[model samples]
Target: MSDELQHLKAAMESMRGELDAMKAALSRLSRVVCIDKDDDGVETVHIECTDLLVRPWSDPRHLGVHIGSSEEGSYIKLYYHGEEHAAKPAISLAMHADGEPHIQLRGKDWKARTDICIQKDHGVVAVLGTNEARGAVMRAQPGGGSVAVLHPDGQARAVLVHSEQHQFPGSETARPSTDLIFANASHDTQMKLHTDDAGSLMMVGMAGHSDGVAVTMRKDGPAIIMRGVEDASSIHLMAAKDMARVAVNQGWLAGDKAAASLAAGGFGSSIELNECDGTKRVDISAMKDSASVQLLDAAGNDSVSLSHISGSHSSLAMRGVAEHDCIRIIANKDAALMRVTGPQDNDTDITSAVYEGKPHVLVRGRNRPLVMAGEAEHGGVVCAYGLKEVTGGVASLAGGPVSGVVSVSSQDGTPLMTLDGTDHGGRLLINNDLGLQRVVLGTKDEAGFLALNNTGSNGVIACATPEGGVVSVCDPDGNVIHTMPRLKDDDDDDD
Candidate 1:
């Protein structure tokens, strides 16, 4: 029994020594200082603490980076020496409630000046200025991004967006587009510049009224539009590869569709002015080798027209009540003519033309007398023709040796009577139906004489010589057979 007791005592002593060694090791491990060696044999020291602050030992107020934890989450705060309060940090990095990270930069007043945050949608957002009055915000997302500049009232003043798909402020459907928008203090859209798959556009307006100005560039061409109101006066300008046009609308109120327009294209160019009732009032046009100006009445009938065509005459025409009743003045390379036409086929024309290498004026009408006054073969002459035919009762004045003359013709154009001035004196003549002379009265050898003829050449004559009066009769062969106031040398004389 004594041997067993000695052995138990030795065992107890050995156990006590081991237990003391374990307690010492545990006490050393309980300290925060931890030292480790990595694969590269680099020694690293780690220390754990409830809070951390970095500052100059001589100035505790001048704190730099302070790291700590709160009931919410862990955070890191940055400070500047000139801060009024140590509790307000200039910068803060923290975890958001949605398990995302957020960073905030504060101003001297401890208000957040800027914030950079990761959103729950795995996007990034940055805001500038205090939370109460944000100045600007920039957001980037998986589908798109946006930058917005805000007014002091927190209304968006301008926004720039790039998106794979987006719904515009006033649009019903979403589309893929990039847009820059400007707004007024009232949150009204003032201007917008946008681009999409189809084209690009820029718009300007005021107080949410977007009809002020618009410019667009599309696949086909470009266009611009300006308006006073939504449905009021407007001007539109458009251009395509082959054509262009400008349109002006007075207003659409009161069911008025009146408009004016100017257009140009490969075919022609035209300007149209419309009346209040939408009737075409005036038209000016230029086409291939031709140009025209036309004035129209309320009924759309032509009132006046001026036109010029290459290789053709230029004309100014004024229309009357009837469609075919018009007066026209036309000028061409060959002549200039003025024509008056009626609804019937009746027309009157006055033309000044070059004929036979001489300028001439001709006045003619349908079924009316013709008057021709021009340079004639002898000299300047005036001719008048009767109705129904040019051969009836023609009269002419010639600037030749026989200056003044009057003539009468029968229906068949046979000379009937004539009174003319000769080189010597005045004369009168009468012709038969067969164009034969029947009577002649003239000054012969400075004496007044009258002669009458029959068909067989027999005639009677009476004359007043310088001395006295005389009478003579001629036989069929034109030989004088009787004479009054017989002469002394004549055998047949009766005294």
Candidate 2:
């Protein structure tokens, strides 16, 4: 009787172990079959449990369903809601390269709405979702937690998205290095721009509380964008290396260069170039409001090309043909120009330009029609143009308001140095070699002071300086032609 009982117990234990093994095998054999209503037949996929599911690419209205082993299946649908029948679904989804999920939505309509949610831990990528009835509307909300998207193509289109909250800052980022575009949306009464890297690029706030949208990039940055943000009101582009360093803001035909130091609203004024190194130039022909052009030279003569354009404003264009050359121009209203060539040497191009609503400007030339503004630390401005052009004890200055007296002196000035605040006069002091020096000011030229050697023979102006005991004159070939002593007497001409 005891042996029979033991045999019965062993048999039961063996059966239980077999059941457990069967359950594990069933779990590992699971797969998701992605089928599109537009497909020729039911396209099924047998995959590992860890692999992500993909919805067959199709129109926004096209439905894609996911079925898991031993569990119920879920379906994704598209919709639309906008004023003037403009609110429509322009939503699409896809799997990010990182194995996460993403959604692409465009608010092509004035006021539209849509929603997207993940019932599981899987990721998603949506390219475009448009309401078949309306032209093109991007409105949707992702109810799930934090997720990222990469939209290399959409970032070049400026497609609008409507969402409760998104994570894309258009400035300080590089995306879809391809055609122009990215992501635009209204959220919490402010319009926000989206990029591959969340908050790296952005657009100015639009009016009203509309759900915002998002945009992203694949892996690499694109090269040229034809009509990026063509439909948005204001768009901002920033460098990836330094989000706050260099940025360009443009919308409705106005362009602004910005630095990290300049306040948001303050950037609309003149440009502020603090610490930087390079050459800057501009051409007003391509600008929408180009009117007049001018050029300013400290000591040397400059050659410039001028033309008249028919826009509400005037513009100046320039090219950086030489290293360490500064270009400054003043114009009235907003304008644009083209570039003819790139900069010479390893120096960067800088422009010190302003739009004063006048009829004339001091700018002309271009290497390319597009302008690139970097960070404030690298010396860039918005609504203000600045370039680098300081050589031999001279620095560029702005013609804006001034504060307490700030002074910068050369090593010897080949002369002594002193400041007469009461008299409004200043002197240059030189102590070392005269390669290239820049005396900068926080304000414009009217209240600024600079002393240097290469004003293009303009002679040191208002500022005062001491004479060097010995002077040497060199020709264009860098050959010393003459030398004179400071204390030689008039009767010492015994040669």
Please name the candidate that would achieve the greatest TM-score relative to the true structure: 1
lDDT of 1 at 98: 60
lDDT of 2 by residue, 73-158 (tens): 32222434324333244553544344444444446562323333343453323333344222222333353222223233323224
Candidate 1 residue-wise lDDT, 92-140, digit = tens:
9987556777888887777888888766565555465655478888888
Model 1 residue 5 distance off true place after TM-score fit, in angstroms: 21
- The worst-scoring run of ten residues by lDDT in candidate 2 lies at 258-267
* Pairs that clash in candidate 1: none
Per-candidate count of clashing residue pairs (backbone under 3 Å): 0, 132
